[model samples]
Target: MALKILSGCINCDMCEPECPNQAISMGEKIYEINPDLCTECVGFYDKPTCISVCPIDVIITDPAHIESKESLLEKFKHLVNTDRI
Candidate 1:
């Protein structure tokens, strides 16, 4: 599943650069994760790097964008093939 930043995010800027897919970016108030680009690091790492580096546990799976590991891997492959990574 894709990840989303919760309301309590500190905007620490720790996640944006850590995302291998460049799925994270600064939003109007805090950082936001692009669901279309987020794969929870399935193809890049065992765990999401954003979550790993987050000082606060504000990042969580997006229930609205639920997906399985296979789907995430497919998305990762698509991103790579399209040069969107």
Candidate 2:
């Protein structure tokens, strides 16, 4: 599943660089995660790198785009395979 930044975000630049999928980006008000690119670090790390680095704990899973581990893994695999072609 994709993670969403809450309203309390401090506009900190910490989370974006930590994303293995390179999914986080600066939004108009705060940082945003690209659901199409966000794999929740399923293939790269044990935990979500953004969540682990977020100092204020404002990151949470997107309920609207909820997904399973298997789906995320599949997404990651697709991304990896796509990068080759």
Best by lDDT: 1
> In model 1, which regions exceed 4 Å deviation?
none
lDDT of each residue in 1-85, candidate 2, tens digit only: 8999998999889999999888999998999999999999999999998999999999999998999999999999998998889
Global CA lDDT computed for model 2? 0.93
Query: lDDT for each of the candidates?
Result: 0.96, 0.93
Model 1: lDDT equals 0.96
